[model samples]
Target: MPTIPSNIVVYNLITKRLFSTSTSKNMNYVEKVRLLDYWKIQDSSLQNEFPRSHLVLMVDRRLLVTKDTPDVKMVEHSYGDLKQLLGEYGLQFDLSNSCLLDALPADNDMIPLFGTSIEAADPPEDSPISKSDVLKQLGNSLGGRFTDIRMAMLTMQEERQRNLLAKFQTLTKWAATYRRCPKCAAALKMRTSKSGAECVTCQKVYYPTFSPVSITLITDPTNEHALLVRHRGSAGGVFTAVAGFAHSGESMAECARREIAEEVGIEVDLIQSLDMSQPWPMPDSSLMIAHVAIAKMDQKISVCPDELETAQWFSRQQVRQALETTLSDPQLKKLPRTLDDRQTLHYIPPAGAIAHQMIRRWVDGKIDFHNSRI
Candidate 1:
């Protein structure tokens, strides 16, 4: 039997969207024909079609945006607009180096463009051109700023747009990483269908891969407190549920238990799985499978010093307070100076994260940790 049931709805920062999933695929036959025409023309030459209003440009991993005003403005340049901007930076504008991130179903003219510079020279290995330096130059040329992709995902309001951005990032990264065949040392070319790469020499087709990870929140036997750990080099004062990549040939339940034991030296009985899964883009694309577990015999945690900085059990009340702390604005809210004997500088994962969702569910009486314990 599968540890994670099929009916469970996986939760994660990027997976939960406010908009319906069908929004991206709602085009009619006329629209489909129009899009086919656009692609046909685009395949021939970028000069054939008129430029749209917005273009989402990604150089390496950063996004070009305008941050001069209070609200950050993403740079959505039309083909002509982007062409002019690239010309100023001594970059070429080629359709071969660009792709559509997403198209608007409502407005036929509102197509989102994603472009990367294919002609830029590879920097030397010893002293490569810094990502910051490249972004600075691009920002200067475009008269805008560049923001990290993670930051952009956090601040972007439109759910559909965020989903599109993730797809773009995932596809672009896959292309860069799989430029050569793994089976044989041969160059690979994108398939005509644009779904995967095919090796020129061996003719092996390779598709994109997504890593699966298991993330769990373990509660004490009494179910009054939850175990949270701080990873080494994590942002100051922030702590989240324990997580690790699923090992080869291991079931999700087996991986969850092993990761819990390996990371914090705590034995846990597998409890009911959380219905939420999230797509984590950092450190590469991964599917985060979340679960709830209860500490078996040993409630006391022994932190793996190399992997985690600290491991502690926070009372349900404390977890609630930490969630509140994360949601409150810095200037408007004031937290207690101290809770019990510890300083009140606790910072939990952001509300968008699956970890935060698990904590919130536990606090809200939605997850019956004690009753669900194995």
Candidate 2:
């Protein structure tokens, strides 16, 4: 999902590589992982070439993770090791519950990686080992704890590891939800490649996909201030850029323009795509496309009660201060009493989020809006 296919022949809006003119120098992009190359290997070839692959274990959307001082790591297990470990607890580890995630190169060999969900074991009534107890025992045995996917994504310091986690969560969710084909309601089997599922009855194929969303940070023509909005049910004082899903037959740039107009009742000009994006898997799978736009001279905002609670233009200095402030639990509580309040402090999305990166780049003058035009 990071890179578009070389032979991609699709909608005009998605055919291009989606290259952004402005790449931030301060951002550390994910490295050493090519999504297209990983999926290129056929399923049969992957199994024959690499019988023992690495497994990322998940239980109820929580990942098995361990902390190493300043860094966090996901626990990867070999096929035999995971099978034996799960067997000890009367659980199954096989293709029925696992999905192909990626193939990463290690030394001269390409190690296949899989995302697996551990289902609860059904014990007899007389058995003393409860499912919770078994899970606890498993965690203790692995010397790691099961952390929520969102928390793990936020805590992971390595970009490659974070991306892998996102991929695992997204793919597993896709597989779990689409077990039957829509055409005939027949059972679907996993495809050998990263392509997705195939229906046995009707010979239908379904590929794992993420919803495309455009997140735009609107700023004044002078670039002195940027606009942020608080959604209806978002956490206290958490304001983010205007964002909405890409409508069918519309390009991402068009989505940005329409979302800005609909969310804040203001038209924008000079829209520029940022050279960064993120695959968000929480709640659902989504590719967050980032953009920066300059609002027209008429800065008056009419808040959309349905989508946003309030929208306001914050000065660059104020936004920078908010970015620098540590948004701990205590800090968030004391920032602003209400969602619409214009207090001395404000809070934006945290690290790991595309919105945060976009806002940061703009504040640091990394997004060169001078050359960016419609």
Candidate 3:
């Protein structure tokens, strides 16, 4: 399995956990929502403009793909690659009952073929345009990537198959509710023909949700080592750099120091900024603000047990080897092993976590791995 992108972010504002289809096979109910990526689901205009190739969902939160047997059309490569993609991330998915091939209606010529990644996105709002330009914009938003789309098709574990109906119904209700005006008493409606919502009375528009956050790796004087901390209750198991949320009416740098103080109990200094960001989704809206900061005191360290267990400083050399795939998962023998604090890198974030992306940047110098601040 390709290293399941230890900190890859699929969408900045939303998140999905990575679990093997084998381990979670028994779950049903709300857990099944994992099957849907609400970030990319389309509206009515989307339906007329780009015929949906298929609707994939989990029957029992076990990895099932469902499609109307009669709705099959264009010859599609069986969705086997999706399985490989999941596996590389150290995750599992079931494909035994998945729809091997499916198609779309002929009139739906505007519909696009599926592939490995998100293809269409709303174009930047700053461009000047013409008719062809407008059409191209719409195409790019829906056409997505033309090939290598990794999808599991319609497959699921079975016990939760009946529950999917309720889940679909819930989504339909939310779709209708989302179209309404939250501020005004006026009834809201979906433009489905375009990119947002319309208020029937006030002519207001509401777009999809996107949230922003800030994350950083803080280091201290002498550049001998950087601030490393363990999460609360990690039992000195997992280790990671300091990071925190960027708050309202505050700058990213301010958030960096505040989070470091709150987590590691040290004052930050001589902070230099890095222009790398990742859209992290943990089931809510968030954009990762990745940066590097300096601390005044390198050796005087104390950790907050409620937020962090113990704090240490690791040299760049030790970090490079510790993060190596072959030797990455190290054992923690004492509460203070290296710095008289027993801590190991135990708590790795989600499959597409932002912290993971920042580490890669420090190592690979490939800011393009993420879409923002590259």
Superposed model 3: Cα runs more than 4 Å off:
1-44, 49-181, 184-203, 233-236, 298-306, 325-342, 346-354, 360-374
TM-score to native of every candidate shown: 0.71, 0.79, 0.48
Instruction: Kindly report which residue pairs in candidate 1 clash with one another.
Output: 9-275, 9-276, 10-275, 10-276, 10-277, 11-276, 11-277, 54-76, 55-76, 55-77
Residue lDDT tens for model 1, 1-374: 13224433232111223122334455555554445334422333223433552466766557776766544446677677778878775667554455445444434233434545344444457756764676588787776887777766545545555565666667667766888889898998763222367788997878767788888988877778888888876655667899999989998888889999899998886555787887766767777889888885455678888988888888889888777877774211342333332323376766546677787888887877545445
Q: Report the lDDT of model 2 for residue 297.
A: 51
Q: Provide the RMSD of all predictions against the true structure, rounded to 1 decimal.
A: 9.6, 8.3, 19.6
Against the true structure, candidate 1 reaches a TM-score of 0.71
Q: Write the per-residue lDDT of candidate 3 for residues 34-143, one digit (tens) a residue.
A: 32222233332234322244333221221222233332112232234444433443433332222111122324121222321111233467756653454333223332
Best by lDDT: 2
Worst 10 residues of 2 by lDDT: 15-24
Name the TM-score of candidate 3. Answer: 0.48
Q: In candidate 2, which residue ranges exceed 4 Å CA deviation?
A: 1-41, 48-51, 106-108, 121-137, 192-194, 327-345
Against the reference, the lDDT scores of all candidates come to 0.65, 0.72, 0.44
Worst 10 residues of 3 by lDDT: 146-155
Checking candidate 2 for backbone clashes, the offending pairs are 43-192
The candidate scoring highest on TM-score is: 2
